[model samples]
Target: MLSLGVRQLDDILGGGVEEGSSVAFVGSIEYDNVILMHQAVLEALKAGKRVLVVDFRQPPSTLLKELRNHGIDYEPFLDDSLTILDGYSNLYGQGIQGGRNVLPNPLDLGITTAIIREALQGDEYDILVIDDVTSQYTLQSSPKIYIKAVVRLVNSVKSLGKTTFVAVCSDVFEKSDLAAILIPFDYVVEVSKGVVEVKRSLQPLRVVEPKFAYMRTRNGISPMKEHYQSLEGLKAQLRAGENGTIWLKDLRVQILEEVTERSLIETVYDFLGPEKGKELLYTWGKKQFIGYGEYSKRHNTSIEEALEDIFKFTIASGGGKLELVELSDSVIIIRGTNLFPSGKGYPYPFHPNYAGSLAQFLTEFTGERWEGEETKCEAMGAEHCEFVLRKVR
Candidate 1:
């Protein structure tokens, strides 16, 4: 069995992929399917297995540079454990003199396959990575020839008891053609709509299931574990427009840009004095929450659920975490941790905005005027921010 470098994926595959099996990482043009393929190659090298990368996306130098960026030690393994076939150069008119094994014409499936099989037949390579099969659309003569070549390669690698990893953009192929390409693989991982789904697995013998979803962030893939259900529900209603707009399909409204706490507070302070700016921000926040409360009332949503949604949105937007500490007939206490550093130098309660919003939301829901005061604040050297709310006489 071989680790794919993603712990969750490895666990889902029942402790990693079975040896000698072929796997495909499939996704649309919106995703970089090659990332996982590169990750797998790095992991294979770490496991001390000799790896052969048939890169169709970039030149050998560029490919090695990328692998090094991923923190792989290159020179030590270059002579023994790692070998890259520069399939990109000659076909792309970069000349064939660039690497140890540069293909004469990668677009020619006959020559390409023969070269690959000869390399794999050697005892030097334990793993094979076709850095992407999607290039077939641009480089191959026809879909029939591409699919045939992929199947032939998979079979040849399997017969040699070597593992294979192939990356392909499913969006480029017709459903029938895509199916033909995937039919030769033992497992498939798919990326779509910001979620990484394991479409197929064999070691555990699992059929289709949502399995899990992941977010591709600037850092890398982050699994949506705790809030997966609610987040997925929200994601389901999101739609992108060709005009560079995003919409909330459920509400039939366009999503707007988010303002950061620092930007909002600092800009307001620059425009107005500290006290006046805080007052204005509080009033603005109160108005927004009142509207949300009205929406909850109109939609028959429970106050608890509405508040949960608000907190989730706040956390998602980098605001912070909020929790209801205590709720009574006469008093309410809300605690906020990891709050945005809004009032850096000011020795006062910085989150007047949130306090006002909560007060107004409760008042709107209960048909009573409410007021809130910040009893503790991180800005004032408190551990967390706390708001105490009470009904007006």
Candidate 2:
């Protein structure tokens, strides 16, 4: 458990971030997210741990002066532990050794990577801060590419048992999807006006603080603090999981009695390795469906209608090949095979558009993914017994 500079904030959050999580301080220039992050660093520094601020957003003087004025001896903060990678977003270098700052060219991540790698090699720091990634978001042509690399880098840091947080602003992105995609976050934090709100997925959303809730009641900072309530509400949703994702699929998918739906959707696949975007489609034509007991009064008409809907699409358009060949009548297997269509390759070629979407969906929805070529299988009857390796892909 880690503690923020403020005891209350740390207590509200799960004692700081879970290891290897890319925490985000999603705030813009006016929102004072930088100040909040500084406070977090102050807490870490007070704990006798080193802090590093990868400052692509601001010059050191102003922020250092601000902290000094706050009765903080920021010079020591800057002594050897605190790092300000000022102007690196615009400073393009040939490599880490090439310290020449070429502002005209794009930020050279190759150079930045080497710098970070060398710094990380020394095991002295516990927390790193990348404040306001909007500049980096704008600097990169495709933000996701850079973001994936950054997450890998963060993972490297976490392997050493350190913590890292990136600052992001909602308005920084043209679309929310891109924001969600870019930041590989374990938790999301929003600091608006003066208040800080904390939320976590795979955990709980705790209202750590109401920075401006009181100010709003007295007199709000229109436009600046207008989103205060909204941010708080949005922060509340963090523990809830991915903006309605929790309820978007309140799916009760119990594959009972060895049904087709059970056989198709209940399968599990490994979820590690470089070969991501792999998928094994059981069928691709339409949304899948199932049936109920024929004479059971409890059987609703909708089940049959839904099954009919599933059958309505023919092989040409709907029920394409089930990724797995008929293996032992009851058990079938498929390995992800396509990268573009799905994030991973599927056992069979899927419709180009739907492949990637479905692979990502199943992984998140049902903890499935295609990892290696070899797969282990168990019969529907032998649900407990496993271990038959089959070469896939």
Candidate 3:
């Protein structure tokens, strides 16, 4: 077993996270669990244990800086005891060369898992920490692939008798998907504003006291006074008010309308031409969904249901009346009447930009790359616009 360096936390677990066992720290937007993972790393290092950090969120430099801010001297463990696999650099299209390994493609689960297993083979690492594992997988691959890879990695590490800590943001994954992923872990810790709730553990447990609170100081996480009387108090603070939520909804509507206007599309296409313009629009559309955050909540729903809700919301907000005319396991057809299409009379298909956006949205929403085409459009003298979507592979 590995000591987390916090007495109360270790006692809660009947020691610390047991060897050959995995623990997941599930957190949300307002409550961060990354700090707890960092503390574990620090504790492991201080105990003279080798640590392997597979970071998919922040850069390695940022992690090092944070360690320094916490008054942890990481200089001694640079290459000998600490090894970092920088996945963030790969996501941004950067090549990091030196002592550390850079994951070239995070989207390929087989490749990513192979690299991780290879790193663990001869390293003799005592602890493995995967930061923001769900976010990394969800952004590039389907939930099925992500869950498989996580289970494989965790089980492999457990067989090697090495402790593993996986951090996941609760807001990024659907409830069912999150529950599925958590099933494999031996322990599940939920971090919120005032409390760190241990929802599951292997050992017989006792009633947890309310005095457990984590405070971050220059020296790292330390025990502090409880901030709230109960978990309900924390939930009350994290919940958004009705007016605040409405204002956010209104703002999103205004921004989407402005960004997806016909004039802006024409200006972009004029400069970049059809191919590059469509590519830019597709990238923008994908990023918008990721940034919006709320779209992820529908991951548990059927693809058709999710798309219907999205189109309904869009139509209500003046995007257009989009009707899902056909839906199947392999194909989808959507007809849009009064869509914000260019009124300019065009002979050929001129909605490549919109088609690109639609393609990206479907891809992210359905967990597959969809080949899309604007079969009929108002620009081409059609009464309504029609889109034919099919799975790419």
Top model by lDDT, which number? 1
Could you tell me the lDDT of residue 238 within candidate 1?
Answer: 69
Spell out the clash pairs found in candidate 3: none
Model 2 spans with C-alpha error above 4 angstroms: 69-73, 88-106, 181-183, 193-195, 201-393
- Per-residue alpha-carbon lDDT of model 3 for 1-393, expressed as tens digits? 677666557756766877668889888774357777777777789888888888887788887787678766667787888888887776774453334478877667889888888777775787888987865756854787788778888888888778888998888888887888887799888876746777888885543341256655566655542212233322323434455452331242122553356667667778888767766765665555552223432322356655655675556445667788999888889888777655657555555545556666777766677767778988778998888888898
lDDT of 3 at 211: 28
Clashes of each: 0, 25, 0
Error of 3 at 96 (Å): 7.5
Which candidate do you rate higher for lDDT, 2 or 3?
3
| 175-288: candidate 2 lDDT, tens digit per residue | 854465445666676767655666454355343232222121211121222222243422322343454434212332221242443334323233322133223432231123
lDDT of 1 by residue, 160-252 (tens): 999999988888888898999898898898866666667787755322243555655432444543232255535755688667767654344
Question: In terms of TM-score, how similar is model 3 to the real structure?
Answer: 0.54
lDDT score for residue 109 of model 3: 83
lDDT assessment of candidate 2: 0.46
Native-to-model Cα distance after best TM-score fit, residue 54 in candidate 3, in Å: 0.5
